[model samples]
Target: MTLTIEELRAGVPKHSRKMITQNVVEVLNQLSSDHGEDFAEHYKQNLMSMSTVLKSGTYNMKDYMNAVKFSAFRLMDHSDVDSYMLAFPERYQRLMLKYADYGDEQSIRADKISSFVTAYKKNEIVAKVTEQALIPSRILNAPMFQTALNIQMSIAMSSRSDQVRSQAAESVMKYTMSPEVQKIELEVGVKGQDEIMALRTEMHRLASQQQGTIMSGTNTSLEIAEQVILHEIEDHDDIDISGELG
Candidate 1:
C-alpha cells in the first residue's frame, strides 16, 4: 500500500499542516517504497516528534521541512555514493554544488555527508532515533568529535608555522581540559533621567524617614536632621516628582 500525504502528516498541528509540502510527501512515499511501510511509518513519527522542539519558535516552517527532508535522506542506507547519486541526482547535484568551493570532489562529498550526518545527529529527531535504535547518543556523536580532534592534532603536530601550531595546541588543550568559569557581566541602567532623579529623591526620603525613627528620643540630633530633610523635601512638593516615581 502506498503512503498518502494525509497519513504521513497525521499528527502534525492543523496550522502547520501546510508545511508538509509536496516535496516532503514525495520523499515520504519514496521511503515507504524503498525501506518498507513500517520503516517509513516510524520515520514519519520521528519527524512529527520533532515538532515538540520546533515549538521553541527558533525554526521557521522552511527550516522544519528542510530538517525533515535532510533527516529522511540521512536515515536511508546510502553507502554507495555512485548508486545513491544515481538514485537522487538532484539532491546529489545540489549538495555537490553547495560544497564545490570547499575542496576536491572526494573532500566535497565527505563534507556534504558529514554536514547531513551532523544535522541528523544534533537535531531532536536523534533523541527519538536513539530510543528506537537503543544506541547511546554519545556513541553517535563520537566519530564527529574524534574527527575534529584528529584535525586539531594534525595541525598541532605538522603545521610548520609556529604561530598556527601554537594556536592549534592551545585549542586542543582548551577543549580537552576542564572548561574555565565563564563570567557573565550584566549592565543595568535607569531608562530615563526623570526616573533616575525620582528614584534618588525617593531613596533620600526613605533614608530620612528611617533615620527619624531610629532614635528613641524625640529631639535627638538624628531626629532634628531628619525633620530638616523632610521639611526641605516638602518645600519642593510643587515640582511634582510623584508622576515620575510611579
Candidate 2:
C-alpha cells in the first residue's frame, strides 16, 4: 500500500501542525542552504501557493502541503525517508499487510530452526554451528542493522542525548546477529558492512566532538560530515546528493 499526504498529516503532531503554507514554507526554508534559498523561495512564493497544485481538491491546502513534504523528503535519503513516511496512517495500514509476509518468512525459518534444534538436542555431540543456518540465513539477512541505525541516528540527532545514542548502538547489536552473517551479505553485493559500520561510528564520533551541534540540520563540521554523507550516498546510491550533484 502507498501513503497519501492526508495520512502524513495524521502522523505529525498537532502543535507542530500549521497551515499548509507555513509547514511547506518552513520545510523549504530549512532546506534552503543546500538547494539554494532562491530555488526554495521561488517555489514557495509562486508554485506552492497556487490553488490547483494538488489533485485532492481545488483549494488543496493540507494535501498539497503533504505532497510537497513527501517529494522534498524523497530528495534526501529517499529510502530512509520512505521508511519514516510509512508512519502515516495510509502507509501504516499497508505496512500491516507487509508484516504478514514477514510473519510467513519468520514462520518458515522458525520451523526449520525447530527441526534443527530438536535434532541437536537428541545428539548434541554431532551438531555443528552450520546446523543452525535457518536463523542467520533468513532473519539476519534482512536489513535489521540499517533499520536500527536509522532510528538511533534520528533519536541521537533530535534528542542530543548520549543515553539515547548508546541505546541505539545496543539496539543494533541486539537485533542484528553475528558478523558472520554480515560477511555473507557483503559477498552478495550488499557493499561493505565493515565500511558502513565504521562510517556510522566515525559520524557518531564527530557528532560527539561537536558538543553544541544540532541534529536534523546541516552538518557544521564540514570535513567530517562531507566524508560521511558522501560515503553514505555512494553505498546506498539513493537520495543523498552531496559532491556528486554539484
Candidate 3:
C-alpha cells in the first residue's frame, strides 16, 4: 500500500525521472499476485506511455536492482561507473567468461563469513582468543573483513558505466572497449583473488576453533531461511489482524 512512483524515486538512488517511473511500474506488477492488482495499479503508469519513453531513450541503469536487503554486498557510485563498465565485454558470451574468471572473490568470502556468523549466533560459538561470548562484530572488525569489503566495492564500481548509463544497454555497447584497461583488470583481479583467498583461510581457521550448536554451514543457511519465513508470516498476520479490527 505504501508503494508509489514517488516513493520508489526517493527510495532508489536518484536517476532520470522516466527511469524511476519505469522501474517502479515493473516492481509493482511483479508483486501483483500477492499485493493485488489494486496495489500494483497504485504505481502503474498512465497518461504518458512507457513505450513512448523507451523510444525516446529514457532508461534506468538498475532495472534489475531491487531495493530489498539481501545477503550480498552492493557498491553504489554511478559517477565512478566508468571504472566498472569497462570491465565487462559488450557480448553476453564474453561477459560470462570474464565474470567466471575474474569473479569477485569477496562474494565467496562474504558467503563463508555470513554462514560462520549465523552458526556462531544460533550455536553460541565462543572465541578462545577473547574468552567471551563470541562477538560477530569482533570478526567483522578483523582486518581481512575490511579488505574483503573494499574488494567488493571495487568490483561493483568496475561493473558500472558513467558515459552512457542513462542510455539503454545497447547504446552503451556501441562504444569501443580499451585493451590496455582489460590487461590491468586481469592483473588487479589476480592480486585481489590471492588476498581474498588468504583472508578466507583465516576466517575458516576462526570457525574451526569455535564450538557451536550448528556446526555445518549448510544447516546454518537452512536455519536462516526458516527464520526469514517465520518473520514474514508474523508480518502478514499483523496486517490481517489490523484489517479485521478496522
Best by TM-score: 1
lDDT of each: 0.52, 0.40, 0.31
How do the predictions measure up, each by TM-score? 0.34, 0.27, 0.18
Candidate 2: lDDT of 216? Answer: 36
Ranking by lDDT: 1, 2, 3
Candidate 3 residues 81-194, lDDT tens each?
A: 221222121332343444554445455324333343334324211111112112233333444544444443332223233212112222222321233321111112133454
For candidate 2, write residues 1-246 as lDDT tens digits.
222345434434343334434455455455465456654553343233222223222433444443443333333444422423421336534544555555664463354333433443343221221122222334453454455456665544444444554455456545544555321212233455566567567655644554335343443435323332333323243212111000
The superposed Cα distance between candidate 1 and the true structure at residue 82, in angstroms, equals: 11
Worst 10-residue lDDT window, candidate 3: 237-246
Q: What residue runs in model 2 are displaced by over 4 Å at the alpha carbon?
A: 1-126, 136-141, 173-186, 192-195, 203-246
Backbone clash numbers for all candidates listed: 0, 0, 2
lDDT of 1 by residue, 123-237 (tens): 6544333333322233355446545654765555445454454456566656655435422121323235464355344544543444455444545543333332222221221
